[model samples]
Target chain A: MAGTAMTPYAQLVGPVDVYVAPYGTAEPAIDAAVPSTWYKLGPTTGDQTIEHSGDLEVFRDNDHQAPVKVTRPEEDLMVTFTVVDMTYEKYARIINNVGRIATGTSGSANVKRLGFKRGATPTEYALLLRGSADSPYGLYPGQNYIPRCVQSGNPAPARGKATRAELECEFMTLEDDTQSSDDDKMGWGTVQIN
Target chain B: MPMIDPIAAILKLISDNTNVQAIVGDRVAGKHKFAQAGSVNAWKADQSCIVAKDDPGTTPDIDIGDHVGRVELRCYGATPAAARKIYNSLIELIRDLEGRTTANTSNGTALIYSLVMDASPFTTVDPDLSIDMVVGYARYRIHEYALEEYQ
Candidate 1:
């Protein structure tokens, strides 16, 4: 499931995998091994979203109250997914981008800690989402790539009954000037479905 | 359009294995049949061959096509003992493919999400051809698409 061909019967499925790497990292093949530099950021809640947001501006003249021209002067690409588990690296980067991470034994006990600190900027990263789709022909697999982005969600864990805690992570994609291709400036993805 | 031909994908799985190919070579033919010679289907009585027959799998999802399917493989060898050996080697490969991808089949391909020997292979005599045979069943979760649909 690692080709670009698609058909009318194809249907995209959940965010099966998620990872983050450097801003200029190339999107990997569906079968390729996850590089050591990339950090796995999921077990998601299967409610992931990739959204194109912003408003379209409409221009109107007094002479023609109903006639006008509309243009989308601005837009944004955002990705959101609920991570169910708490991991050291994921929490550190999200909570305090400038936080210090340390690991040692408290006497005979093992311990790891994230020293929280205030920071003006979030760390930039290259995010990748590997997803699968179904088709009549065979398995269709591919990945979503955001060349550059920063975590925009500041969700905290909330406890509940009959429900599990989830960290709603969101990202705002930014233009990667280093990328030469137009489609890859913000984000891009394709599934080998159908 | 298919990623690769599905039948070819299955054939590739068997042909790609050095052990299986050493025994059957390009003899991993299609749909319970032997390979054809210049003009007609032919195989020597002592020659080895692996016959494949696909079944219409159970549909796992209606919206996004996926299948839990079966493929019956018949191993015909020079002797009954040899048939068991071929079956053992082939099953080893198939078992290893439980969570692996099939070579993009000619008609289509699939991620073999999970595979298991639904029916274990055993040495037997083919009633119709009187050939030494070992038959088995593979239950597979075809993640993307399957040749079963195309057939």
Candidate 2:
């Protein structure tokens, strides 16, 4: 008599691919094929961090030492990764699309420049992460989708060495009220193990 | 699991270079000093030659199976000036070492992602073997994905 078989091959373990597009769109990434308007943030140096957090309300009694119950009212989802492929577009995205590019001829040598300014508000994007599929866990590649996401924290790219200059960026998702269900508001994925 | 032969890769890096071949004339080989089945006289007939052998052990990435290793290069010639010529050719060859995918220069399953010399080539003596030789060390970084791609 055999029990549940170990499914190592079905485990989702590999590099995650990050993609981004404009916000408020119906579907930016369709059938795992990124649209022309979308941009794939190139090679990341290390692991992609997926974090899920929520505001917990603990009900405590005056006489009791421990809390009775804890309830979560709001939840947040964030993903962080370091992009190694240095490009004007990656810089602009980390800065929430404030930067712009222009070309000019400087003393007979054609030069392209990426320029940006301060006080500009952040921009929203439809973030898509294509992770490996977990067959036994019934998790698919296209399921992890965030309809509205905005970059969070300050981005500092350290330069120099045999190591490539990497821009570390973190993005937090916003609730998309247009969706019918709560699960569809932020994003959906089975990322837990018990 | 077959590992990459850094010695062969180093030898290929030298033998495949036109400038080095011009100096040593296809006499580049492994640490055997003579790969052909011949007597010591036959081996020394074309005394101007280059040989390479890898250092024992490796330093790999913590998680991934990428290997970081070193290879020692030996340049032998009949005269001191001739040995220096081979060393000079190696110096010129090292200019194009960065960002090289070993698939392009793989002589026999020796793959490398990148390479750089530890320092400038220096002179070494072998009175017993009786030859003028110069020695240098090259460090190489080989990624696991490159080997997986080959598989």
Which candidate achieves the best lDDT against the true structure?
A: 1
Per-residue C-alpha lDDT of model 1 across residues A1-194, encoded as one tens digit per residue: 43324432343332357788766777776666667777788777757788999898889999898748988888799999888867767777656452457898888999887776637877788998875432233466666889899988877788878777777888889989888887779988755643
Off by over 4 Å in 1: A1-9, A62-67, A96-99, A105-108, A132-138, A160-163, B1-151
lDDT of 2 by residue, B1-151 (tens): 3445556666776787899878777777775454345655245634788878776565655744545678778888877778888888887777555233344334334345556678677786655566788888877765433233333
Q: How would you encode candidate 2's per-residue C-alpha lDDT over A128-176 as one tens digit per residue? A: 7764342223233433578888888577777666656788878899998
Worst 10 residues of 1 chain B by lDDT: B142-151
The models' CA-based lDDT, in order, is: 0.69, 0.66
Put down candidate 1 lDDT per residue, B1-151, tens digits, no spaces. 4444333456667778888988876678775454445634577667788887775655544544455567788899889988888888888886455224555565554444445577757678888788899988776554455534443
- Reference-based lDDT, residue B115, model 2: 67
Every candidate's chain B TM-score: 0.76, 0.76
Which DockQ value does candidate 2 get?
A: 0.04
The most accurate candidate by TM-score is 1
